[model samples]
Target: MRAVNSHNTPGLAGLRFAFGTLTVLPVRVSRWDRDCAGAGMRWAPLAGLAVGLCAGAAGGLLLLLGAGPLLAAVASAAVPAVLTRGLHLDGLADTADGLGSGRPAEDALRIMKQSDIGPFGVLALVFVLLAQVAALYELYGRGWGYGATAAAVAGAAARLALTLAARSGVPAARPEGLGAMVAATVPARQALGIALLVTAGFAAWGTLFGGYGAPRLALAVLAGAAAAELLLRHCVRRFGGVTGDVFGGVAETAATAALIALAVGFR
Candidate 1:
């Protein structure tokens, strides 16, 4: 579970960083410098893919065991949370509290940093989790393949948004924290390249699944990216820049948007 260090090849180091920070996996990231963070963000989709596969496998296995789609969907939704130790969800709740407060940027940031969940945070958590499970249920109803593939696509898309958000020119709201350490670390060109590659990879994944699955998946990622972009912009405007909580919020938003798009658009 030890993470690869800076001394390792760049790609391996990046993968190590991505998995180490993004998940509860045993990978131990030794380097937290900007270079490592940049590469980690670039490789974030790989971490997402791994998480998705595990989640989808859990749901798919439940379906094979004769479980109902509703139960399977709940299982699928639960895996990512368990895997990440609910870090993203917590971030989502905090970001919701911050945004819903309508306080000034400093005040809102402070609220987000608080450990307690405000009313806005609770509402946001309930609705977003509902959206995720509902969409997963629909996909599972279509068949295990649909649900599994959607899980992977949504997961990858979720991390892809993080990569995009870390591109050059994006600022961190504060001078410290994970968000600032990784902020704008990725070059714009590199981000664009990684995005295109991820999209192409997803399309390739769908080709094996048949139908218009390719476009559906590609579009799911696009939709997720677009949705994340909107949230990112709004957060930046409201909070003065991005924070770890905002990153979590964007990831969840992207994942949900991707799942919904895949559920309704392709079929």
Candidate 2:
């Protein structure tokens, strides 16, 4: 799957594909094939790193400007939504609605594809957003650095879940959509390797902060990934496979779980 562009390096092509599809960024994607998408999926955490950086920067600036932790937290929470055009959030809501519908697999999927959000979707969005903001608020109250790192780590961790999801053997629930384009594109070994590197990198960064920070952050990210994996399994069973909405749901689930873990840990 060496879907490189004639004018761009392989890495650049992958980054472009990652950012172009996963975000509302201005980067143009030169290729739309599965090879390109696979490369992009492998690079997803990098795209998330960018999103998290911007998110952290926004919240940190708000804190510098004298905004309270809660307000800064809200600003932090809004960045990912704005950056990703709320597609993931929408997917979370849809997945919630579909799951809550308690219908058969085919019917539940049909409900998920509907344009309007149901009560379950509304509730899920409200609670998830509240969880994210509250966790972020706790981190910000500790200090801007804590909040910023949490934001960045959570963002990367969230996409790490997606990288795992896209690895071999996960089938797409639908024949179409972004899930189908990227599903099973990554080798399981490659995905696991990336996961280890990401976790180790974040843990090393935490070590710079000294003491228990390293283990705390490492556990937080692993906890987040665990939560997302559970959701992925449930979605696979209930929906019969993965979908764009399932991807979104798992990503948000991972972020929220990480943030909460970071907020509550090492106290």
Error of 1 at 12 (Å): 2.0
lDDT of each: 0.91, 0.91
After superposition, candidate 1 runs with Cα above 4 Å error: 1-7
lDDT string, candidate 2, 59-94, tens digits: 999999999999999999999999999998999999
Pick out the ten consecutive residues of candidate 1 with the lowest summed lDDT: 4-13
Q: For model 1, how big is the CA root-mean-square deviation? A: 2.8
Question: Model 1's lDDT to the true fold?
Answer: 0.91
Q: After superposition, how far is residue 38 of candidate 2 from its true place, in Å?
A: 1.0
Q: What is the lDDT of residue 255 in candidate 2?
A: 92
Question: How many Å off is the CA of 4 in candidate 1?
Answer: 12
